[model samples]
Target chain A: MKTLSSTWKEMKKYRHSYLMIAPYYLPFLVFTVFSVLMAMGLSFSYFNVLETPRLIGWQNYINLFLQDDIFSIAMKNTFLFVAITGPASFILCFFVAWVINEMRPKVRAAITLVFYAPTLAGVSAFAIWKFVFSGSEYGLVNAFLLKAGLLMEPLTYLKDIRFILPILIVVQLWMSLGHSFLAFIAGLQTVDRKLYEAAAVDGVRNRWQELWYITLPVMRPFLLFGAVMQIAQSFGVSAVSINLLGFPTTKYAGRTIVTHLMDYGIIRYEMGYASAIATILFLMQVIFNKTVQRGLKRIGE
Target chain B: MTNRLNRSVGGTLFLLFFLGFLGIFMVIPLVFTISNAFKPLNEFYLFPPKLFVRNPTLTNFTDLKQILANFWIPFTRYLFNSLWVVVLGTGGHVLFVSLAAYPMAKHDFPGKNLLFSITVLALMFSPEVTKIPNFIIMSKLGLIDTYTSMIIPSLVFPLGLFLMKQYMEDLPDSLIESAKCEGASEYAILFRIIIPLVKPALMTIVLFNFTFVWSQTSGEMGGGYIFSEKLKTLPYVLVQITQGGFGSMQVFAWDGIVAVINFLLISIPIAVFLITQSSIVETMATSGIKD
Candidate 1:
């Protein structure tokens, strides 16, 4: 006891550094590490808070990948959502940012804020999109079409699988435009204005030529960064879609992998199956991140 | 000379079209939300939608009040709950992230590199996958339905820590070493030397976190609307209002409430942030520039 106490007192001599770090470090370890380990453990068995986890081995994973139709839908839809929205948002935001960056600083800030305003709409506007695309005569889009003398009847935009995915894509595009747009704008500002002046002196008459010669080359890292971020973001579509459109509407078109996990975990209390779905999502995201990183490095080099 | 004139006209037209599209895309929804709020009950069903309200009255506002009364709890309580989470969550995040980031920024502490890697990896794994386990852990902590549960789980601010670390790394090492050599304690160095220098980054962190946290708290993810209606946040309340939680006659009325709250909740902070330190946005953007 005396020896241990002496050792502890000696350790206290360097305690200032650790104490400075302890507040952030200790809580992070507990919640992040401990919580994550508990989740991995939960995947091995059938445990809800109500009862002891029954050991189930690989049964949960097998059923999830093989038998669960909803899981399959979730995988397909989520990937498709990521594929479409990710690149489109990036290109569009980059284009806008590039244009805005050409303007004076105040004008650039004004345009940037104008683009950022949609994000402020948050999910509330998305909910309004439900009304906008509502199937009935009450729907704004349908009502517009009807009054335009274009259509004989109202279209059920949310219900059909065809329209559901497009609706989700458009909404995602609208909300996501601002943040990455800001990121790209920030990236654009870093380009040396001297590069453009030199290019113009060399008789680069057009914007496209300037972009190829000056902007893209200079802002490659930021562009790659924005692209990867968009990919990560578009794949993370579960929260917004799930909130706006509940699961299993018109053949489960809107379900994403995260929503699938949420269904099993939160609503169904199937902790094991949920964990399995999450594990797959984690694996897939890891692959996507790696591919993008490789792509960035290759482009950079 | 004529060809040059034509090209200039074409360029201007292209800019106008592009800028116009972006403007409409951003503005229409805001216009829609505000327009819908003011639309009379009969106008809600009108085809092609009335662009402007003919009889704009306090009726929707009055109806919103009546509808709010029908809720299991008062609408203002949800507003307060949202405000509470933002205040505490933002405070906790700003404090802890700066605390953790300052040492990592200045000191060559052991395991700093490893700690940084962990934080970066944490950002990749979105909260979606972790929802189940996090929920279970929250339940175990007896925080499932409380305001603390909503705020505490996300309070780690790993992203903020990384941002703060990146920002603080830009500072000269001599700034801190001088303080240390002056017989100032580590805490004193952090409090006196570090925090003051990182004001722009601090503002950026606060702005981004405020918006992010505000948006999240308004959703079902925070369990903001599930139980204890009094504890529901503004977004959840808006959801309820939209989904007809207030009953039929009061739908437009409730829409007004949703509008007012959403506008108030977001615009107040944004206006304050933008108005006071609009310059910060440019500075932060430039600071973020890698040169």
Candidate 2:
């Protein structure tokens, strides 16, 4: 590392560059960077909204792991979500973008919109699924099953512990083709067409061979980006869960770490405990992303 | 010849079939939401829950208007609040992110790599990790219950900066070098040369920020910040009305109105996206994250 004096001198030399970045960076430091540091620090203290934080050592972390049953369930469910949705969405996005990339430009744009509209609609659109899965006899799925004699009675899909996680997974996947998908589409367009001709001349026989040799390596950067986006999203799957199945679902069935954090931080106002949960989640994502980044570097090698 | 070598006809057909199947799942919810908005109340409760309305009516729209009219604050006030916040938030975010991104993409500055690394680190985690601390900071700044609380925090989106930097890097150094040799000011070169060249990236930023800020007006971002009734926004009010703000009992009778409001909430962003989709595609084409 450079000495502090030399670093300061360099900053002064590029003062114009510093000036350009300050408007955005200063607020970013206060809002994002400082908040992250404060959360990490607060995880070790006991602070409710009404009182000053009292240093409590590792009490929050201990309680979170050893004593809290609900936290364990939340942890399990969060891992399940990240494991399933993260890779599923990442591969699905790349595949869908690859398929559509071969279509005519006008047709491609329309098809992209079809897949992307759900994400663009944000969380509010998830309400439509409520009607489809509504518990009453008049609910779409229930009514269809009843008419078809497939079920003896109406089923409340959202409330059923057996179905809640699966349904959440499906809905999450439905909206999963979001930012990364768009990035993939853009990345696919950048792959030079001439590479395929060159590869074919080199005796590449089939589409899979071409993809393995040419496309995957060429798109590695985007694949890495898409992986990070999916990891972040799948780990933070609270809004859709809360919107669909209420905050603490049946027996906390669909409760993820984020919902658990919300339970403490927002409702109970146990800022210290919530920070511990947040720090765990933050660590999980960073570690997972680092691993994925390394793995993506080996793609097509 | 290259196309034939790269893709078999059977492979193309199979992929199309798979796409078509997935497209059904993707499109049905949207179609159901739209069709339900026009469904008469009786059709809403029909046996077997019809996907299409046999008799369409505007009663849901009229009911929404009536519910909104009964609010203590005028509906237009919420509209104005949403409009200004979205405009200012989206515009400021794009401008600030792009300004910071230019130097990081093109210049050699102290701590540049460190700042960019922090940005990548930030991108790995979601905002929930920092929500409580951000709230504390907002309260400390005396920005609570104000528009600044909403607009100011969103001005430095890392995704926008990352994308902008990537797009800007694709531009050859010679372009900027030539402009510099002519003794042009940094501001002039940025505004006259760089900005116009990077329109696709700007469009991408604008579209993403617009969708984000539009949805945020509904109290997701502003829920803790803005407490006053008059300071509330259109979507927040709509959510309140549909999710039993007036009363849960009344909401049961207004299912059609809820669908109508959901349609309105989602369509605006989708429409804005449709208008800017082409430019976004262009922007993303160069948006690869190079090390």
Candidate 3:
């Protein structure tokens, strides 16, 4: 009885600890771990979501890497988007954050909001921007270009394949300004003011030099994090691209991995194939994240 | 000395010119959108894009009214859905995360280090990887398209968990020990003692979740809207409008602009949330860093 009572006492001590963490941990284990295990298992089979999934055994993956033309295009577009948006957003965001950080405190906060505001704007703002960039004669972009004598006629920005991806890239940079800018701002705030002051005393007078030796080296972790996030975000560019600009753009330029997944999963009812694509996307992100983590570790050292 | 002074002046002028160029590039879209919101349809189509809304009318507002009428069914319901989901969802997140965070940050449990490491590792997984499995689970539970589907899945935010854990790690440990010596229950200790101390972290989580939840509805419009046309959120309605493809041009009306404006109106809560919480947001960004 004494032993049991002592055990109960011990258990009671840990009860609150268990309760505190369980809400997030349990759901995470189930949804993140269990569901992922199930998805991995399901990827081997032809699951229509309703019907019992039959074991197809690697055929879905086989087809994804081999037979699918749309899959190739989707993969290509996703890579292209990552290539374009990742660096463009990162450099632009880092520069803006640096500039904002250079300002006085009140002015800095206000301008940070200005730069970050577009990111908070999200799709609603994107839609408004879409109107401004519309192909019509009255569309602000076209109207301005026409007035400047750059072009005699309004260009079909969304419809034309040559311009669609770049347009998407630009829109993405603007909308995502907040997250990366905040990340950069977060990074910038951590730079040792003493280091900069010492550098200034040693004749490091320009913004460029101070940023190079003091700022960049100090903010390396944040820079790595922001870069990784941008890369991951750019990789998933299909969500906005598909929604804003339809798939099979005049040249199939904007059809991304996600678009292909939606096409198969929702439009075509090929859940098995879609699951395979999702699996590949998961693998790619994991690799990218690990690489960034390694990079961050090196920078930390 | 005069030549050096001239060079400095020239350089300053060049720098100002460049800054102005970039500023204009950044500001034009913003100015145009706000201006166009108040402009008449005639002004919208004008070449050189009228810099001012000459003869600004409430026509846009009237059009907004018509669109709101058409969209009224879905818009309000969606707003309510998002509000509850974000509120309850973010609340649950903050509560659970802080609870978990305090233990990991402060206490030396049997497996604390292992648990902390794993939690940190979990932060690396992208939401896309987890989303499908989450959707499947939601479907299995018959929670698809319901508020439960949206809110329940988000309660376990890895990033929030990580951030909270990181924030709490810096907290002084004596606070917990003092409360313990008072013979306070652990629940009392956590709820009464630890939570209030982490107001900044809590506010950051709240503000982050509020903005994220609002924007997520915009991005994942189809998932939340489900089959109920009346249940469609503001962004979902805009998506539907856009996705309907311009093929439905016959139905195009002035009301479309109003509908868009009404969509913009829904952003006010988000804006206010950001403005009020801006300081907290700034702190979260800058607090531990070199600044």
Candidate 4:
């Protein structure tokens, strides 16, 4: 309904905003958005880094589900990993954070530091885990077991399927406690004590009742935030698996959807196939994240 | 009175037990890693791994130094690369996210919802999801093996934008209005006034980016993006040394060298976290909670 001059005037009005966003947004577009688009495009074409990409349509997607049985196993393992670690860490972080929040200020800060310290050290800290589960008798687990008279010989935890998944899950839970834990602690701090006092006068007799009636309801947004972040995190468990269990663990036990993607994208240089895997992971995250977001909306009610 | 006293004792016991579990899971691992750097080679290789060191020494540091001296590239060069990229990258991440955030947060500009949704989308996908496309794009731009490739992509950290916008929205309108009345431009208002006001938010993201990038390039994982041995960061040097193996670098107990490197790698972030954690938590004091 507008004429050219009016449209131009409107554009002129927002010129400053356009300028402010351009420098950063341009790089963001190139690196994040445009690259994502390129990945989607590459998903439909076969390129081996040297040849010109040839269009291959949905075959990549088809191959992902049909021909690639290892991917199905990987997908299943990822779900199990997500199912266990996601909620367990969420409740653990919240509960632990709540308890820590009750401490004197000095003690609270110190405890938070020790708990969150695992993630701050990131992969370097992961180095210790490799030794813990190493094949050598000098490895912590092996040494402990040998000294305990549990085993006559060292067990190869990383190479053996029986031990790999459980160990990876434990290590995953440890490293991930930091983010949501910190967020929960911060969320707890923001909770006003007056609410508890007010609720107490209303016949809230004990801590359990206070938590359900007061703290949980009050911290719904943080709960939602933690749920979404931890879900996305559990879904995308790649680096730690690769580090602890090696890229492709024995009998595909430690193979995650991410490792599968790496097998194609990085190892084989099958960019299109890799892109398809990436797209699937991308879609799964969006789906799971949204479902959690919707599910958490009415928790207190 | 007896029932209440018993309950108090029970609560204290539970808390103490929980703290002990945390020490076993969290503290012992780090303490063990740090202890690796100080232990004598023979002590390191001991079958029942000694929880503490008897003959603590600095030979690990010297061993790490001796190896680095053999490399074609200088160890200082790798350290420099990591420092500058992290410093510049973290600065850019904060500056860019805040700039884009200011307009998006304050103004009723067109397409604000669309723009904000894109950031939320970006945030949802884990960093690993983006690394593939980001890597592809890096090669497409011929930025592979370049520091620009490493630093530039990380500069657009979406979490910073999300947090910055959230922090900016909490700023009182009267403050910005007063500045506007005094004839300050948006740029001046942002750089001079608004950013200073959001010091806690700024400090939090700065520390995160510093810790993250310092470790990222330091070869915590795969030494993302950079390839040339000389262009490598400090941790990459550690990776090459250990990965290249026993002839030059000892494995496990005999390799106190890797321990010292990991010690340095682990300490910086932990030390920084301990020192600056209060401010980071301080930002969250009012963030995400609404009356």
Candidate 5:
């Protein structure tokens, strides 16, 4: 009773603080928190927007796992994307940022802009990729390969199931140097210059040794942040698939969890099934992020 | 810093060469988009395709104007809608997120850790998971098809709050304590002391919010909430044109115009980033996630 009273007293004292945050927190509650809970709940029931949601126990999830072939394809493709793009982008961003850190400030800023430009271009830039991979002799890659005598026929890249996933991975890696890259560049700037001097005095013989010992240790937090960002981005790889390969690619070549959710939720109005997919994805992301966080914590230990 | 290990000449050259090679792929699409916008009809369909325009012309821009002139809604209306959402969304996001971030960073309140943890957890997952529920909530609240549906969700971007709080935590407690000793209120101190000191973070948040809002298509942000033709955003209109919604114009000329529209859509956010680029680096210096 005394502890409860003291907690109430603390809350009363911080009333002004509560008032200040209410504008943001209230909307956050409705849009993010409440919506997350609602998605979890909706995963257990069936609703098509035309009728009331009816409780069906675990049927939706059972249907998703046991019956849905497309869901399995999406799951396999999503895992493939995350496994490849996540680590590649993380290491790529860090290495690029490390290299860029060695340049003069003006050059650093300009190089940063060049690498970050594709992400800034947003989805509209996908048009340029379409033109490059237009599946015709006139397409940029096809033309170049043909001129070099490397190809006898034009390859329909986006439409070909064999080529779609790999091409998407490349395009994804191209745009992957985004916020996390900037975070890394900034993180590098924050490492105390004195540490490098100390490491050198301690007989650190090479740049690689210095990086492993000093830079990686100091950059642990940023690395974790970068990992989380990369995981979210890699797992959420839908826009590229939807834009480049159309909504449903040949043989479901590039279907991901998000695009699957879009298929059922937006087009078919299978709200329950879609919510189950989302719930599974949410669980995968949260669990994966937690694992990465735990693993990052062990770095430099 | 000067006593650090010197990079080998061969290694340095190899790294630079590697960067240059990757940089070409990084830059080609953007260059092609810009160049295609200026290419004439004959150049657009040239055999073995040209990466640059040999003969630049203003016809693509004029042709785009003509195509847009045929839309049911005036082109200016789309522009107006975009500006309205971007300005308000970015402004509201920066202000409200910072306001919330201040207390989280500096105050000793109940549930502070829990609130911060929740926000971090929110950041881990993609927002796409919540789209269905958010749509249902929006319809329940009758915010569907309104500007509020677009602007309200942006005000609480978890990353913005996370970055702002991380940046603000580096501000010395002595500053806020001194302000308090001078009889300043929390709001006054935040505006007078915190905001000025954290200008880099503020600018970074502005750039992020601006980029997000500016590039969002109606289907992405509004999530099918918007139904009115007049309420659609500029990107939505540009996307429609590229999808050949404005009707079948000459194929080659339309492709050039599509390129022009892509260039226009991308350039503004790039400009915003250019203005705020330095501060983003500065803000990110302190944006480490503490365990």
Candidate 6:
């Protein structure tokens, strides 16, 4: 606390610089960073919608890990989502960008738009998936498979835990191609064509060799950027769960830490439990980011 | 000649395969969304689903017009509310981000690295994780259920700041140095010299922010922020209409109209993307992923 005061005094000397940055950092502190800290604080206290929060240190965290079965299930499901979607989508984005990077400018634009359509449609627009996989025979999946004689009966894709997570993964991947894909496209364009020319002279006889040795090294930054966005987007899988799988989802198959947070925060009004969920989710994100960043260092090697 | 033909055949086949996969997963669903907007009511519940409309009709849109006519606050008000909010939010975000980004990108100020680091670290956690605490903060500041609540939080998008900073770093330091030698204040350097040079980056911010805020109006996400009907946004109203939560008519029975409404809601951002395609894609390419 004493060091904070000293830093404040020192900050006064460069107040203008601080002031210039304040419009962003100040609101960011108040809205984003402060709220995050407040969430950490609130995790230690009990508060329903009606009452003032009461101090109940460690109870929420204790119950979250030990007593709450659903939280564990949510964690497991969330890990499954992140594990499956993050790497799969990142790899997919890179390769697609590589392929598209070879096309003429007009062709590249059209293909990029085709791939980027869903992302532009936004999360809400993904509600189309609900109708596409709707339980009724009128649903797109049921109609096609049945017409093709693949199934005698239409399965309830969203309601069935067996199919929900898998279907959710598909829709998640579809929307996941947005920010990272464009970044890779742009990054690929930024990579010098002369490098490939030089690599060929250096005995890089194959496209794979060229990609591994030149393209990958040059686009490492884009890969890392795409990975971070992928990780965050995949881990933060609430809206898809809620819209596609239904709230509290059947057998808790679609439940993730985020949906659980929403369960407590919005539905049950258990602010403390919800904040605890938020904190744990935040901690998970921080850990994943740190681990991936450390792993990126080895990419150049 | 045969060898060249063989290689070209293989490449064409690969392209076909890629397009086939994308067509099934990406293209068809989008085609469904657009075509289904014109679908007839009976076509919606048909035993076998159809992708293209059998008979195109304007009934769904006319129904929408009727519904819009009956809204207590009138439909144009919601439209204006959403437009102004997006304009203000996106406008403010582009300005503030670029202002901060100039110093962070160009200057050798104390704690600059730390400031840049905080924003980068903040990126890993989207607003969803902190929505509850943000709600609490908004309520404490009496901003909940107000336009300020939405606008203020959005004015400092972390991604936008990082994007601008990365772009501004590409600007030559000599540009700012010469201006400084002439006794121009940091503010003048930023407004007069820095901004004009970084117009493309600024356009990128505007396009991205517009799409983001435009899409956010879908009531499921942050619909809880504004309670008053007049303050509500277009997408929020679209959600309400789709769920049959608004309007007294038996509109839910008409899935075609609801689908049309959903299509209409999503089209705005798509238009914005097409308009600013170059900057958005180019800016994203320049977006470096690591420290």
Q: Best by lDDT, which number?
A: 5
How many clashing pairs in candidate 4?
1
Q: Tens digits of per-residue lDDT for model 1 on A195-295?
A: 77777778888877777767776776566546545766777786557656666457788888877777777787888778877777776776787677566
Could you give the interface RMSD of each candidate, to one decimal?
A: 5.0, 1.8, 5.7, 3.9, 1.4, 3.6
Q: What's the ranking of the predictions by lDDT, best on top?
A: 5, 2, 6, 4, 1, 3
Q: List candidate 1 stretches off by more than 4 Å.
A: A1-15, A198-206, B1-12, B69-76, B224-226, B246-291
| Residues B6-102 of candidate 2: C-alpha lDDT, one tens digit per residue | 5688988998899899999999998888988999878877797877779989999998888778766778998999887877788888888878988
DockQ, candidate no. 5: 0.73
RMSD of each: 4.7, 1.8, 5.0, 3.1, 1.8, 3.1
lDDT of 3 by residue, A1-301 (tens): 4597776676577776777788878887887777666667777889777788899999999999899877898898788776777777888888777755655667767666666666666555666666667888777789878889998989988888888877877777766664556767766766667787777778886666666767777887567556656766777776567656765455667788877776666666666777787788777866876776676555425
CAPRI band of model 2?
A: medium
lDDT of 5 by residue, A97-200 (tens): 99889788999999999899988887787889999998988789888898889999999999998899888999999988988999999999988888988888
Flag the better candidate by TM-score, 3 or 4: 4
Q: State the displacement of the C-alpha of residue B103, model 4, in Å, after optimal TM-score superposition.
A: 1.4
Candidate 2: regions farther than 4 A off: A1-6, B1-3, B219-222, B246-253
- Which residue pairs in candidate 6 collide? A186-B285
Q: Tell me what fraction of the real C-alpha contacts between chains A and B each candidate also makes.
A: 0.40, 0.79, 0.37, 0.54, 0.74, 0.57
Docking class of 5: medium
Give residue B28's error in model 2 in angstroms: 0.6
- Where is model 6 more than 4 Å wrong at Cα? A1-13, B1-12, B247-253
Ranking the candidates on DockQ from highest down gives: 5, 2, 6, 4, 1, 3
Q: Candidate 2 has which clashing residue pairs, if any? A: B145-B225
Task: Report the poorest 10 consecutive residues by lDDT, candidate 5 chain A.
Answer: A198-207
Clashing pairs in 3: A189-B291, A190-B289, A190-B290, B64-B258
* Alpha-carbon deviation at B102 in model 6, angstroms: 0.9
Residue-wise C-alpha lDDT for candidate 2, range A1-301, written one tens digit per residue: 8999998998888898889999889999998999999999999999897889999999999999999999999999998988898888888898899998877898899999999999987756778988878999988789999999999999999999999999899999998898899999988988899899888899998888988899999998888888889999999988778888987799999999999998999889999999999999999999999988998899877
